[model samples]
Target: MPRVIVVEDSPTQAQHLGFILEEAGFEVVLAPDAETGFRRLNEEHFDVILSDLHLPGDSGFDLCRRLKADPVHRNIPIVVCTSEVDPVNVLRGLQAGADGFVTKQRPPAEILGCVRRVLQRGCAPEPSPSARTRVTFLDQDFELTAGREQLLDILVSAFEDVVHINAQYRQSAVALREANRKLEQRNLELQRSVESERRAHEERKRAESHLIQNEKMTSLGQLAAGVAHEINNPLAFVINNITLLRRDLGYLEAMLSLYREAIAPLAVGRPELVEPIEEYAEKVDLPYTLENLGRLLERTAEGAKRIRHIVASLRDFARLDEQELKEADLNTGIASTLDLARGRASELQVALETVLGPLPMVTCYPARINQVVLSLVTNALDACKPGGRVIIGTCVKEDGVEIAVTDTGTGIPPDVLGKIFDPFFTTKSQGKGTGLGLSISYGIVRSHGGTIAVESTSPGGTRIVVDLPIRPSPTAAP
Candidate 1:
């Protein structure tokens, strides 16, 4: 019987796995922690080892590393069984020499399947099918009676050789079957490669488009700022003239009012009053209009101020420089990114909330960091439906700062979640998104000696967390 070892901390979980393996017709051995697990391995050889990542003392990863480093146990295939299904966890498990990784949430059938495959591989030897078989024949027709007996013995020996040859032929046939299976697996891997390449090509195109859009926006912002400045210079004179004209009109109206008052008292006679009123109206045409010229001037000034404000916003959005490192406040960068993406939030009708914590000034490229924050926030907004909420929080940690952007939006699909950070991989409609935002953000954070990750639930929402170092290390460059 094939022997299988399971290393887990939980009694119920361990027993359940052991029962399943026993039901599968394998001799099962159980260890509750890494210490006992290592002892079990030293005491007996096992076909496969199923280990939980989180054990009592040593972690599954550490155990795997130790096992893989041991010459005696290195050939034993290890399957990591854990509740953690994050990409990082999966990656770390593989890095630690786990031959297979299966989440505890997976169906028992899947776990059994992995166990069977690993044990089958462990028990089987590599097949060599291509070697040719050799055949030799001997004839016994020499002596009469004694030669007849010799001929029979020779024939018997020939028969024995024939049986041996047949056994070798069967072994060769089994080897061929194994070779064919391996070929099919290779073909399947090739197909997956082709598919991955196709996706990569699509991603490249999306990245190009995203870069083009950024460039266009930058150009437009510069143009807008120049036009606003030019217009402001001419508008300043127009505003000044409008103000002076209103002031002169006010003085003229005041003088006319004084004249009217003086004339009203002096001209008690109807003929004199009529003549004075006609003369005043002819002098200034004050009764010809009732519009407030001062109000018009005020409205003009307000419009100009609004235009200037818009221009300033545009300038801030477009400001980009060569990647130069400097000390910067992360909170300021977050605020600016929010301002830049305000339009996107408005379109989605998503409310944005920020809880900024006290963070140390970090040396990083301000523009690049801003771009990263903007990309993350934009992605969060895009994921959300109308009336959804996005929360941006930041805090200082022991070695760095953590920024988290969370959204109450449609969660990521499980199948495509792993490829989210791959360039050009998008879940949006064609022409809607280029899908390079997260990839670029990931790159920027890495450049700053930081890490970025996502947590999400299907049909629920997603949260992106970024941890950045406070100071850029010269030797630890990204």
Candidate 2:
């Protein structure tokens, strides 16, 4: 690996530069100032040296000149890391024998490339005189005959050498300028290419995500219809059986009443006969049964009706039968989602509460809205501890409804919160979640011309609020 020395007075800046070089697979040595930089150079050779432009004493230009002046260290390439951005300062550094100049503000890659090029070029091969040169003059014989021939020949040859050297230097400088211009242009093009590629990648990812969501919606549409039907079928018998049981209880009550009336007269006619009847009534708890039977039957019927309503809700929320946008009461959608989640919420011992405000009907895909609600509610439930509670509520906004699902669990951390809506991101244990719930919900809300936002703090819980337009956006897609 190449060894690099970073001479920077600021400890922080030196450490940063050292880290960059080290991570790039270069061995880095640090020097706090020019004096220390020279001390390290004497101890061991380095492939390259990077020095900051500004130092307490002996600035980078002075160091570059000193290194170049020393015969032993003259070959070591030095790159100036400078805040001095003016072209004149750069030329001054080059004149002092610095191999390259890099602005401190340039990214690490740019600096690394600069150093690499300096190494490739290898300390600007010290310009040397050609070993052999052929110089012929047509007037050589006449010059030899003249008495001043030797002086004339010496002057001409000296002029030729100076002219040749000047032409070579000019050519080298022009080539260097062209190379620098091309490097600048290439860097700009590379940056633009990177940006364009990033945007294209994002668009492709979004398109793929949309395709996946569409597929999921299709499967959900199919599964929801069948599930609703299956649940409703058993619920129908339960409702009917409860109704019949309630009627039978009434008949049994009436018969018992008549029997009581007859027995009362018998007891009054013969006090001795009342003992056995009283003992039987006490054993059966007849008075208690008569008092509570109607209430029990009424509650059972009401519960069965609720089960039926829940089944209907499953179908409505899935909207297996509806394909177009329609005006819907947001309250109804919230209610259905709550009912659908009620069973799981009970199992998890999480209390569910709501405070729905009166709101105007908003045009939307009702089933999709229900799906979003169900997802948000269950996500809240998942976040809750056993004794915690989740609140699902809605209120009227300026021109739309705001649905919020808040949970009593510890709030999401800032880092994780940003990714909660990213597709396939989840904090749940494996197999317990698919990680697509919040992402799909977000897409649904966005497609309806709405926004979903979250507010949270540790131990204070989290509330995700969704805002929608009063009417569906014309640009919304299926």
Candidate 3:
């Protein structure tokens, strides 16, 4: 078997090189440094010397120069093994009488191939140069005494290695670009898929939210209807009894007046009987009581009517009777919303005002319109302080009617204003908001071919305006 010595300062590199050469059917001798390698080389006859450039004591360059100068070891071929790829270092290694050069970064097979090629070349004839050549390279000066053929061989070999490395780099570069292109394509596909899934999820969530709000409105309508029914029956009898009592009180007053006329003549002779009747009348204050009784009944009836009006407003707000598309007065819807939100306004001490202008009836989903109005008004009230005011107004537009809810509250922050209609977005404290009010309202308005927008008002306030078409296209129908 061909014998080779590997001089490497690193134990791992020495073992690795040893393994590769031994597996290639070569006898391997491992040396930790140049001193040990030099001793080994002098003691034994080796076919090849694979020495690393970096050593503990003398470097591989120094060892090569010393061996080439010695008569006994001058014929042995030396290959410098290193990780350094600097052209200056390569030239220096070749100038040191190294027959071949291989970098550690090269594949193991390439390193082994380099050694085999040198072995095949055997030994070169010694040349005596006329004079040493002094050259300046990369701002450093070096004096070399190698023959022209040796120098030519070194340059050609280095140039060949450069050409081979360049070809490999080009192929690697092409492969890498193709890989990156495919990776980019894959990433784009993944992004598109994720975006599509996100849109689907949002659509599903929107549908579910609409359904839940509809069910809530339906349930509210049923409850309101039940409450109205329960209250109306008793209210009817109370109203009837009040009417009857007022009529009977009028008859009794006339009869008492006639009795007073009849009793006046008896006052002189039947003084005791007239005196008892007059004293009882004076004690009871019958004259004042008879005068105020009519007014009292009228006020009581007015209060009962107010109660009835409120119940009607609740039913109107829920609008169970009008579920489909129909002509609805926007002003009336605003009124119903105001009525429903009145208690909350009162509790919050927020003033509620209406600037209702003449408006043409808009064909829309009445319940949905009412819901939009209620949502806007409720949000307005919530944004306000105790002394703040909310104004709900309706006006006629050229193509439709506009409902505006303006509040004297802190205006929405610039950053938060844009995302107000985004689903599940809210500024309210957790548990206090579901964050779907404006989103649902926006959907509702759009379904009716309407547009809802908001703007900041003067002196820290907000105004939400909803514009609804009088008669929407068929596509807008829910």
**What lDDT would each prediction earn against the true structure?**
0.73, 0.80, 0.86
What's model 3's overall lDDT?
Answer: 0.86
**Model 1 misplaced stretches (Cα beyond 4 Å):** 1-160, 163-310, 321-323, 457-459, 475-478
The most accurate candidate by TM-score is 3
Question: For model 2, how does the per-residue alpha-carbon lDDT over 207-307 read when each residue is reduced to its tens digit?
Answer: 76677877877887777777777877888898888889888888998898887788877887886887887888899887887778888878888988887
The per-residue C-alpha lDDT of model 3 at residue 270 equals: 89
- Can you write out model 1's per-residue Cα lDDT over 271-347, one digit (the tens) per residue? 66568666866787556542555567678878766656555544544454433577888797778668767778998
Ten contiguous residues with the weakest lDDT in model 1? 140-149
Task: Provide the clash count, candidate 2.
Answer: 0
Best of the two (1, 3) by TM-score: 3
- Tens-digit per-residue lDDT, 335-379, candidate 3: 877888999999999999999999887889888888888899989
**Which ten contiguous residues of candidate 2 have the minimum total lDDT?**
141-150
TM-score of each: 0.50, 0.58, 0.85
**Model 1, residue 97: what's the lDDT?**
57
